[model samples]
Target: MAVRNADISVRRGEVIAITGQSGSGKSSLLYCLAGVLPVARGEVRFDGRVLGALDDEELSALRRERFGFVFQYGELLPELTVEENTALPLRLAGQRKGEALATAGAVLSRLGLGELRQRRPSQVSGGQSQRVAVARALVHQPAVVFADEPTGSLDSANATAVLEEFLTLARSQGTAVVLVTHDADVAGRADTHYRMRDGMLAPFTRDAS
Candidate 1:
């Protein structure tokens, strides 16, 4: 079993961090909670509804409308400009292109990418690309964001920059965040911390300053 007997609850607007070594089930737990993976024997709830009870279309709607995601690498479509990439979620949700692009532009500006909005992923630095990924994730004003090793591909400085901006925006907007990483420094920024080992999760006490 990848994860067993773990009970995790996240309050609205809270930031939670999960840390563990590779193959320790941290990411598995995240996937289960995010409804990206089916649970074999447990319940995953969101907004008071059991995720497993939801049909595939319901689950898909939930993900598209309420949740955002960021991965280790910035997963941007190479052909799209930063603005276009950031506006994708809104577009998928049936927003008019002009309106979606406008919202995307505002978010990119908020992330200090106002000048780079027209650039494609290939034209930007890794950090900038990651920041754009973040912009895309937040453009829809998702209630929660799931980040899996979000800073893994960046250098120290870029990682720090991207994370700072990400948390700042999430906090300002009261968006909950679930961040999975193996880095202590990254986890330190969360309001709550947990460590996964041997397919189990337990609270780990540490100053979150």
Candidate 2:
């Protein structure tokens, strides 16, 4: 199925929510924007940089340096401690072990996971593990964060906690957040919202009688 063209701009320190039913092209839009999927048409830009013009290597570098991603699943390494998992991106960027771990420590602290840094993913609760995923994504201090169903597996309270943390981090660090979710409560928390239907996205509107 062909995905529809979307022209969207997200500024610093704002949270933008993308909501749609399953198979509505929400995830496809994200993948296209992130350069994970090739765009047959249309263009994506970030902070004035044209994404479509970049080669794969260039896109990878840009993504590494300028973007963070949180998948629905934690995607943590089984053998790594929370701290190690959180430090992966920094390490990938060529920071020394000490520096990467330090950065991870700070991010974990910010996410309220400092006390559990030494534990493995299997040793923590689902919510705590997901928090570690959030820390990992933010450790590199990217300009934009893309999250796909970030709270999809959590309980109500846990989902709320994670959503609030995402908003707080974006606000405090001046990072732009683009989140994909089916949850209305999660969508409602965003600064701006868009809903996808039949492969097109439109601004969310509420009826006031």
Best model per TM-score: 1
Candidate 2's residue-wise lDDT over 8-38, tens digit each? 8888888999998899899998888787888
- TM-score for each predicted model, relative to the true structure: 0.97, 0.95
- Backbone clash numbers for all candidates listed: 0, 0
Candidate 2 clash pair list: none
Model 1 CA deviation exceeding 4 Å by range: 206-209
lDDT value, residue 124 of candidate 2: 96
What shift in Å separates residue 124 of candidate 1 from its native position after superposition?
0.6
Model 1 C-alpha lDDT per residue in residues 14-65, reported as the tens digit of each score: 9999998899899999999999998898899998999999999999999999
What C-alpha lDDT values do all the predictions have?
Answer: 0.93, 0.88
What lDDT does model 1 reach?
Answer: 0.93
Please estimate how well model 2 matches the true structure, expressed as its whole-model Cα lDDT. 0.88
